[model samples]
Each structure stands twice: as C-alpha cells, then as structure tokens.
Target: MTGGRSPRRAVAAADRTRQPTEVRRRLIVEAAVPLIAERGSSSVGVRDVAGAAGVSVGTVTYHFGSVQEILSEAMVLQIERYYAALSETADRATSAAGALRLLVDALFTEDTDRHWRMWFEYWNAGEHHLDPAFAGGQDRRYESWHRQIRALAERGVADGEFTCADLDGFTTRFAALADGLALQRLRQAPPLTTQDARRHLHRFIETELGPGPHGVGLGPAE
Candidate 1:
C-alpha cells in the first residue's frame, strides 16, 4: 500500500501499546511535578503536562478528571519523593542526633530546592482559591512531617542524646521554625540564604535541645 512506517515509528507505537495505564498515569504525574515546580501550579496546564510526559493531551485527560486532579497527584508524588529522600539520608546516620543533623542539612540545600518550590506552588494555589483538590491531604502531609521530627526527638530523649523537657512543645516549635525559615529562604525575604536558613535551624535546635550528645547540631553553616 503506502510507504511502510519507519522502524523508529513502529517501535514507538509498540512501546506506547506496551505501557500500562498505571505506568502512563505515573509518567504524567512525574512530568507534572517538574513543570509545576519550574512554572508553578497555576502556570502549568494539561497541555504542558502532556508534552512533558510525551503523551497525548487526551491521555492525560482520560487519566485525570481535571487539571486540579493532575496537580494534586503531582504534589502527592513530590511529597512522597521528598520524604523518601530525606529519610534515606537520615537513615545513613548512626544516632538520632546524627539523623536530625542530616535531615536539617538536607532540607535547605539545592538538592531539595525544587521540592520546596513545588510544595509552595501547590500550597499557594490552594490557599488563594480554596480549591478542594489542592487542599486535600495537606493536613495529613504536615502531620507526617511533624511525626518524623517528633519521632527523632523521642528517640534522642530515650537514648540520652537529648534532654527535652517538653517533647510535644519542642516538636511543634521545631517544625514550625523550619517551615518559616524555608519559606523566607525560598522567597528570598530579606535576601535569606541557604546557609542562613540552616544556621537558624541549627541554633533553634540547640536552644530547644541544648548542646549535648543528644543535641548534635551542625554547629554553624560553613
């Protein structure tokens, strides 16, 4: 009949057929994460996501009910990856204090900047519009983050690495402090630097936990 399809075209068609719906859905979300990170949630659209994912616009629409749905899924993926990486880094440490230090160090670095950006993008969109899709699971995500910090504090106290008088208070304050500092740093409010953020976080840790075996602060930003 007509000229046959090229090997590359045939392979591409075969690959598309072989990819499962779940795999393609995940791909769309993964692609959306970076696009939302770089352009923000309000700026990115389904067309942008589809192009990035190398899938048709129809495929994205088929998988996600709306742009908000796609955005929410992307945010979920971002949070999961964020925690997994931080947990992995902290796991390499020998003690609870060491793990806290590792976790703080990992938080304000370039490696995690994109994650933070994407998080804020989603948060701001949700806050401004009060969209349910953007608002969903936010509290649960924050609780998970708080739990990680609380667990570290509890472990330190148990291991004699920390002498916290109020575990709950310290956990709440520490988590809040980190979030505030990160927001300021991300916004460059007063021109805050990563070193400044890390230093501030470490000082807060030292203040709350006191310098000891259990309160292994990073000392200062070098």
Candidate 2:
C-alpha cells in the first residue's frame, strides 16, 4: 500500500473541511429543536445535542456557547417560523373576521401540536429555571402573539365587522382563552379535539365581538 491515509479517514477529513461554519451552527440548532421539544429545554445537555447533530460537543459549544444558548435559539427559531405561518394565513383572509377564524384554525391544528407542546415545555422551564435568555425569549413570544392578535382585533373594529368597546381587553381575554384551550387540548385525557376547541373559541369571539355583517358570524360554519 502507498503511504497515504486510509479512505475513511480521508473522507472524514474532507467532510469536516467542506462543512461551513453557518451550516454546522444550523445543524446543531436544528438538532437541538426536536430534542428540546421531546425532552424539554431544561433536560437536554450539550453533549446530547452534539451527538444528535453528529458533531463533537466542542463544535456545539463553539457555535452556541452553551446549552442554554442553544435552547434559547431553538425556541426563538420555532417561534419565528410560527409567526411567519401566521402572517401568511392572515394575508389570505377575505375579511378581518375571516382572518381571525383562520388564525384560530392555524393555532389549534395537528400541525401546531408539537409547537404548543414545546411552548408549554418552555413555560414550565421558565417557572423552575432562571435563564434570562429563555425568559426573555418567552416574553418576546408572548408580546409578539399579543401584538398580532390585537392588530387583527383593531382591523375587525375598523371594518365594523366587530364591535368591541375595549380592544386591548378583548385581545387579552381572547388570547388567554386560546392559550387555556390549547393547554387543555394538549394535557387532558380524552383530550379536547381541534373542532371542540374551535367551537368554544368561536362562541367566545361571538360573545366579545358580536355577529359580523348580516349576521354572518365571526368564524366558519361547523
């Protein structure tokens, strides 16, 4: 045999050389996301993420600084993706009432179940742990969600599709109701189905905003 490195060793070296810094960072973060969702942010370790990402622990630390940083970034990434989807849904609505209905549908669907689970995991982590990054990210998520819902409420009022004397109060109440219903659907035995949650939320919206133009109501028909 010639004086050359083995094939496997050469391939490994090439792989390492070909991987870009940003690619490596994203791999680690993406790997961490599912782990955090499955096991909660507080439960995952740096080595676990590195192993899952097929990188060394040093590589994870190099990119994210710490497990907490990786967890925080993963949470932020999920929320950003979710907001993008919500914005897309909002863009397709024919009216503000339709927008609100579509938003509720988007939130409680099977596609969002993992996201809701991860969210509650983060909420639990926030209660027991004291990481400022995680806490700050959670707060920003709450504020962003509230801001979007409030904007939708304002639009409905402006279009005279809804009648609310206190927009902010209505937004807060609506958001709280959504959160509570989602939690119940996630945590309860004989869990609340998406249809059940939608019906409850639509009833609440009707109570808060009244019927839309020509008694069309604020949500889709059952």
Candidate 3:
C-alpha cells in the first residue's frame, strides 16, 4: 500500500468522488485527524474514524489496514493543509518577509486553526510511536519557517530596510519565538492575533536589520 500511489497524488476531489477506494481512503483519514486531536491517538481506532466519518468499519480497515495506519494518515492530513496554505501564500508574495507573514496568518485563520490544536494534541499524546508517520514533519516545518525568515532578513539587508548581525541566529531566535507565540495563542487565545505576531515580528526585524543595524523607524510604534 505504501508503494502504491500516495494519497496526496491520488487526492483529486472530483476524481476521489469517482473512485470508491480513494473516497473511503480520504474520508477515513480526514476523520481521523480530529479524532486523534480530541482523543489520544492510542485511544482512537479505525472504527472510531469510520463512525465519525460516516463510513463502515470495514471500509476504514480496508483502506488503512489498522489503527496505526489511520493515525499515521491523520498526521499527514494535519500538516498537509498548513503546507498548502504556506505554498499558496508564498506564490502570491512579492517579498520574502511578506510571504513569512502570510504563512503565519494562514495557519491562524479561524477555520484553519485546529491544525495547531491537533499538533499540540499529538505531542501531548506521545503519538509518534503509535503513528510512526510524518516522523520528521516538525523539523521540516521549522526548517521551512527558518528558511523564509532568513530570506526575509537577507532581503531587508539588501534593501537597506533591516540589518542582522547573524542571519542564522536571528532566524532560529524568531522561529522559537513564533512557536512560543503560537502555543500561547492556542492555549489562551492571547490578545495577539497572528497579525499581532507578524506585526511584532516586523518590528523585531526592523530593530535587528533597520537603520544602523536596528530600528524600522516605522513611525508611531505600536
């Protein structure tokens, strides 16, 4: 099954509707992410996802083989949406920093915010052993975020709008801050929105990379 066409490539909404295997497969996993998010992955089963997705238990087992398969698929399901949003926003971006801003905002959108919730749930549940899927997803996600931030810092330096003594160090610093901020917002719905996160980020960059290697002079500071 792993060697066969990946669900991602096979993911065709209209086409999925046309294929029973694809349709059941998609439903089973899509239903599983939230299940695992709300209930620990170990507690979630193929039957659970099938019931939630309104499909037969047999159908879920047929597509996923076991609870492990279902949970692993859920991991993929959670991150795929976030990456898709990032890619789409990046495509429309004119600047690297703008792309980074869009990436955070997209993840925090009211309807899409559950992925963040799901992430915390996964970690809290110690799900890696159960799912064994998307093993490097967190590292990959951080790398992508850091790459964008570094590019933005470089661009600011080039445009004389920002400065940074060490691009790599600053990127890591901000990525850590972004995560802490995301977690805070998730647990407590801070006064800060994703917009606030980006605004603070922009201000931080201005300080690190702006005039005299600091300060955006962005006028009446927030």
Candidate 4:
C-alpha cells in the first residue's frame, strides 16, 4: 500500500509468477514417464513424481488427480509422440514399400531405442494398474496402423505397384507382422538389425507385386 506491499508480498508475487502452470505440469509428466518407466508403479506415487519434478505433491494431484489418472495421461501423451514419429516416418519414405521399411526402421531404429522401450516399460510393467481408458488406446493404435496399411495397399494396387489377393487380410497381416517384427527386434537384436528387416520387407513386397511402380507415401527415418 505504501510503495509496493512488503518484502514478503514481493516474494509472494514472484512465486505467483512461476512458469505457466501447464508448461510446468507437462515437464513434470515428461520427467515422470522415464522415472515411472524405470521404477515400478508401486514404488512411485504423487509425492515421488512431484519430488522428481521439483513441484509440491499438491500441484501434481491438482493437475493429475490420482495416480491412475496420472499414469493414464502419461501413457496417452507418450503414445501420441510415438505415433506422431511413425507418421513422420511414413511421410519421409520414397514409396509405399520404402515407407513400410522406413516405418519398421523408425519404430526400432534408435540406438538407445528409448521410445519403444518406454512403451513396453510402461505397458508390460504397469498394465495391471493402467486406466481402463488405456485399452481403447490399443484399439486406436491398431486402427491408426490399419489405416496406414489400407492407404498403402490401395495406392500400391491402383498404381500397379503391389498386388494382393485380399486387401483386408493383407493389410491386417502387414500391420500384425510389422508390430511383431518391431517387438521381436526390441526383444532380440544384434542378429536382426533395422537394415536386415527392411531388406526382408523389400523381398516380401517384390514377391507380392513383382515390384516396379512404387506408391508415393515413402518417408525418411523418423
């Protein structure tokens, strides 16, 4: 009221000026993912994440509500990044076939392989306590991959780039095989490099359609 409140008021104002709440919350969630990924769910909680995030427990609970909700939101956020990376992979390939190879490589290509590792780390480790909403994300991921397969197949067939007896079965199998191969590579590597997997995908495409005019969605590595 005199010149400007008091010294305590100044500090309170400074505290109020802390970074945008959402930005801080996102940083916390991001930091929490790798933490929760490495540590089991039971061992980590609101206070733990808040401590890791350098925030108070009250802030985390206010933003994320409960542990289940926090895990759910964290997984959803991480998966979006994962799928976005896949989309980038598709956008960079040279043809539908190259795109397919790139997609496989993109999924399993990183040296650290942190992306998929985080996924399995959370998925395998935390599925039991995961929110029911997470189950829908599984279907959503498959549907998204399914759409990519359909687009690739239709484009390939229309241009006479690839042939298939059954688009549905072909697309389904392609998605399944790609996922299976990605998981296998994650589970066991050194023998199965991304290059080797792409090599095999090329052969499969060639055998399927005689290979000539490739489709256009091919994208570079993500």
Tens digits of per-residue lDDT for model 3, 1-222: 112221222244464456677767776678777666665676675556756676666666677667776776676678667666677787697754455556556655566557766666555544445433345665575577677668766765666554567989888887777667668766666566766765666555545554534435232233
Off by over 4 Å in 4: 1-17, 37-43, 121-132, 189-192, 200-203, 212-222
Q: Which pairs clash in model 3?
A: 162-209, 162-210, 163-209, 163-210
C-alpha RMSD values across all candidates: 6.1, 6.8, 7.0, 8.8
Can you write out model 1's per-residue Cα lDDT over 40-139, one digit (the tens) per residue? 7877777777777777779889999888788878888898889888889888888877788888889999767788887777677667656664466787
Which wins on lDDT, candidate 1 or candidate 4? 1
lDDT of 2 at 17: 60
lDDT of 1: 0.76
Q: Which stretch of 10 consecutive residues in model 1 shows the poorest summed lDDT?
A: 1-10
Global local distance difference test of model 4: 0.62
Task: Give the per-residue lDDT digits (tens) of candidate 4, residues 1-222.
Answer: 012211111123345347687876776676566655555455567766766666666777777777766655666677778778788878786666666666655655654355555566556644575556567666676588688767876666776665667778767776666656656667784467777665655545455544435532332323
Tens digits of per-residue lDDT, candidate 2, 1-222, equal 112221121124347667899877877788778877766776688777766677777877788766877776777788688888998999799888888888888888877777887777767767765777667878888988888988987888777786778889988998899989988988876579988888888888878886555444474444
Candidate 3 Cα deviation (angstroms), residue 109: 3.6
lDDT of 3: 0.62
In order, the Cα lDDT scores of the candidates are 0.76, 0.77, 0.62, 0.62
As a TM-score, model 2 comes out at 0.84
Error of 4 at 67 (Å): 2.2
**TM match of model 1 to true structure:** 0.85
Query: How many clashes in each structure?
Result: 1, 0, 4, 7
